[model samples]
Target: MNNNLPEKQPPEKTDWLLFPQEISRDDIEKEIKKTPIAIQKILNYYLLTDFESKYEEIHLFLKHFNENKKIPIAKINNPVIYKIIKTARSIQRQIHKLMGLLRFREIEGGYLYASFTSDFNIIGPLSLHFSRRFPEEKLIIHDTKRRKALFVEKGKLYEVVSLNTLPSDTDEESFFRQLWQRYHQNISITERENKKLQRQNIPLKFQHWLTEFKGSCALPQLDGNRENI
Candidate 1:
């Protein structure tokens, strides 16, 4: 999430009715509860979008929805609302793509490590996922673009930090990485290759960290296995 909604101020020239108060923690919590739980989820996801004006769009939609309290937000035909919904879906898509693309290799001390880049700030979501997926494992997922790393251990998300260095990969880890690449290369059918479709599925922006395309994502339900790292 962008994490700036609380600091977002109304435009100076806007009608007072539209934005009566500056955004605050109390205001957002109150507004979120006024809507259905499902819509509330969408609102949270909307904040994950990389849109430059997402806060403005969110404020606009909330104002509109308030004025039309008689109608459900889902039934409203507002452009801002539509944009919020679309962008939220896009956020989910990126998360799903990262889940499939992330490749972890065992580093020194048996810690799993994977690094990838994303335009959106998504380390929080990714941590929720891997922490649950590999509950007992100690791992790190690095968002190289943001220079942040999420650490997961004993089925719980740990501190997010700016890592200056990572554990070194051992000879065994390097061997497996090469073997995986070789297997991937040999499985390809050159005649059936479609570069355009390949690019569409795995954009160059996301390919840098994928072991297959030459890269890598999110949260899963932790089943009764939570423990301190």
Candidate 2:
């Protein structure tokens, strides 16, 4: 006779709630259904992104709503409401920035690869913009800080934890990168250079992956192995 132990399952979000040990997803869903349709849409769309502080904010909001079945309207006056709004806006801003700043390099397999680190998890939102912009192309937007990626092919999108390894840039990509750098340099006037404004617009942290700043299209190395989410 042989005995094998069952595989362990990861902890669920409800299992970690401190005050209300018996709270469940069903309870949250019921409470969410009671809110106005517009408020429900805002909560469902913006608040549920992969933000690190989301769970805590969600828990607090749910707890408050359970006691008083109302969504806070005055966000500026209410600290909790303000914090949640701020977090969502931060993610939105990052998405906007990445959409504009992301420079994709065509690699050996004719795939566009772009890698950048974002303070907030904005890959999911970014994928929608890029997929629409390049409908037929295969694109990978890697979030180096979070070790996550959004893969888009033929207008379809999916996520991967870590990419296998990015191939080197194609000859055309190299030529264009050099040409862009030269153009960027020529356009700059030393008398008109504004370090403070440049820093504010494109923070120093993001310069590494920007082709014009680095003078070349470079792929960043992925960290150690990561399990798919």
Candidate 3:
């Protein structure tokens, strides 16, 4: 071995030796400003085209906003975010609508099935009501919009079945509906004739759920149906 041994190879160089240090925000802003006009336009447009872009805009806006003091509408130019906001508002409007619109047909296998054409988020609240009311029944509400099904099976809740799955009720369900209609009709006073009060009691959209609604003859069998209880 050589006497000096080449100074023990001077320890291997590390990435930190050659790596560039982080630039100051001012320097970064200056460099970003120097970026081509077309490139800036492309970056701005990137914030416009997609949902992820909105997240990116939010991230960049929050990141740069303190020092930058102003975020150009151009930097965060997302019409999609507006669409999402509008959709969210629309969903809020439809919460009561879904509450009214959802039709749960009790089936033979101790299951409650319904098809909902709304956001999956709405199902969380809906499930709370249904599961509380029908704790014993296995419930499934499929959202056609998301192509996913929310199943409350044996008291557990989650999504299932990406593919479409249709549900069916028993033939006895029709006979039971007739009996319920008769009961409803029997309870109604023909002499009272408060059409306005009746409408207020049950809205037109919920007409389908009413067993006595002129054309809906399929009243569920109320007798043994209480077995679930």
lDDT (0 to 1) per candidate: 0.76, 0.72, 0.55
Candidate 1 lDDT over residue span 1-229, tens digit each: 7866776566773434453445654566577778877778788888775676566667777877778889877788877888888777877888889988888988998899988888677778888898989999998988888787888999887766567977787656665567677777879999999989988998888877777664210122333434531
Residue ranges of candidate 2 with Cα displaced over 4 Å: 1-53, 62-72, 75-77, 216-229
Q: For model 1, what is the alpha-carbon lDDT of residue 103?
A: 84
Angstrom error at residue 162, model 3: 6.3
Cα RMSD of all models vs. native, in order, equals: 11.3, 12.4, 16.2
Question: What digit string (tens of lDDT, one per residue) describes model 3 on residues 115-136?
Answer: 6554324666677667776777
Pick the lDDT winner: 1
- Each candidate's number of clashing pairs is 9, 0, 7
- In the range 1-229, model 2's lDDT, one tens digit per residue, is 5578788664752324445444455665676678777546545545546655554555566555555555455433446656666666666677788789998999998789999987766677788899999999999889887788898999999887668788898766776788788788888999999999999999897889898997543433444453431
Q: Which consecutive 10 residues in model 3 have the weakest lDDT in total?
A: 8-17
Better of 1 and 3 by lDDT: 1
Candidate 3, after superposition: displacement of residue 80 in Å?
A: 6.5
Clashes of 2: 0
Rank order (by lDDT, best first): 1, 2, 3
Query: Which sequence of candidate numbers ranks them by TM-score, best first?
Result: 1, 2, 3
In order of appearance, the predictions have TM-scores of 0.77, 0.73, 0.44
